[model samples]
Target: MKMWLPVVLVSLLLGGLPATHATAGTRSCNNNGIVVLHGMPLVTVDHKCVQILCLNGLPMPKLFENANSGCCEFKNTLYAPGQVFLDGCVKMTCEKSKWKPVGNTEFRCKRCEVFNDPHFMSFDRHRFDYHGECTYALTQEQFSRTPNFGIFTEFKKCYAVPSCLHRTIFKDNPKLLIGIGYLGLNAPKIYDILINGEKFTIPGDNYAHRLIVKEEDQDVLVWRQGSCIRILGSNGLTLQQCTNSIDIWAHPDLKNKVNGLCGSPDDNIDNDFTSRGKQVFDVEGFAPQEFAESWLTPPGCPAGRKKGSAKKNFGNDKMK
Candidate 1:
């Protein structure tokens, strides 16, 4: 069953009525006439300048007006800024805040849409929707909070992401160890890298320090060595080495290796991009649940450790 709270409570939160019952704001207008606030044309037998109060279920102006100046009675609906509601396919949103009700001013609400494309994944009420085709994360953070707008209706915030030029690959099972295409010098400045279920953030400023991918060079291998992952460049040059879930994407080619937590990166499958990697929009058919357990593991030991230890190992890392 649909339930609703009393409007008086809403008014309290809105700070609509005065705290005390003082007749200071009221004065005698028409002699033998009802008493009311000085300028307002409300007719009341009691000389109370107190603002008229009404609850949600009560009807309009007559609730607070006397028979004499009942024509002056007008009801208003209050709304706060950033609140969103839907009026069918078009959405309505309050652009500003209004605590107390005023007369005749129309409430202006902007209109919006729920879906920009049908091919995109379905919108999840609780979580953000990823628009792989446009690389936007549609969020419900901006939905309206106005009373009666809707508990379910949500306005969206389309967040732009960096380029998704790489593809995806998998080891024996695509669920647990998912692979991103090989990384190159021209990789996106910002993107998502998920290992298991953990995410790694690579910002624009540290792109040069965090990534080193040779264009068209398949000799270098990027793989998950058990709990630790590493990027093996030419001449056995270790571009990057860490044991935690690695968060970065690259092309589909190069090679992939999976080793144990204490195992070397060299022992694993060499899965390269057999063809062009799938784009974001094309992934709707592939369910996200197919991925195995996504755990939040700490990063593997530091890269370039001496004798495969978590010691400083990037002695020859050129800051390209």
Candidate 2:
């Protein structure tokens, strides 16, 4: 019975029961109350940007310098380092856990106005008059850049006058087009507003992609402000149309980057007579008639019979 007892005990230990031995060559890590095996991916908890991973039999934690925790916050969204965004007309970028201005932070806007009898005021503040009946480029990015845009004005006879701004077109690159038309100079109200060839209503907060339309008294305003340019890829175009005039505002970033009737916007009025063919006429010898004819939209529109010299109020100061 004793011999049988010994054999039975050995048999039970070898086969009848599971072996009681420590696991070999196996590693794991304990994170709080959770168990993680070796070779597992990094794990994050409670939205903490810091991550932990199991290496060998121990847990290792690492902090990422450029992680979401270090990103810039704008309007409840996170922006990675070096990501650029627009705050109103100001350009900003994310860096070192903060939002910083990308270039010049100053908010500078240049104004160009076309008023009564269609007097022209360039962005550099050089004023002139062109009495031609044809479509002409008001302002354009002569050197193509991203989000290329331009404005065109159509002149027609109004109240027997040879030239009056009958319609204005704001073209955004290859897709978006906005037009504001007037019946006549004396017409008390605007005839209509067009978006991509379709009649559109004013005061539209949401229309034509990212454009915001609103009515300010007698003027119809179209603009893109704040972070709206994230989708439009532009600082934004501000167009204000009234009964007898049109005002176009350009962002400071566009300084020295545009041409056409608005002329070069380098803060130099002497070069305001830049022609469509890239020829700059001397302000002293400036021939307003020839300069106006060079900007005819179709290259060969009918010449205005009532030709006159532009006000030579700008002196003989050479372009600097």
Candidate 2: Cα lDDT at 281: 78
* Model 2 misplacement above 4 A: 1-107, 143-147, 182-191, 204-236, 285-287, 298-320
Whole-model lDDT, model 2: 0.53
Error of 1 at 50 (Å): 14
> Tens digits of per-residue lDDT for model 1 on 1-320?
00133434434422422223223233422222333333342221111111232323121122323222111111222223333422211122433221111122122311111222111112111111212221111111111111111101111122332112222222212233323332321234113344334554343321111122222112222333323243322221221222111222111121122111111122221211011111111222332311100110112112431111111122332321
Q: Each model's TM-score, in the order given?
A: 0.15, 0.53
lDDT by residue for model 2 (43-162), tens:
432122333445564444444465544444333234566777554344566565444544532257677778766677888887666666677777777733222577777776779544
Report residue 244 deviation for candidate 2 (angstroms): 1.1
Q: Please report the candidate that would top TM-score against the real structure.
A: 2
| Model 1 CA RMSD to the hidden true structure, in angstroms | 26.1
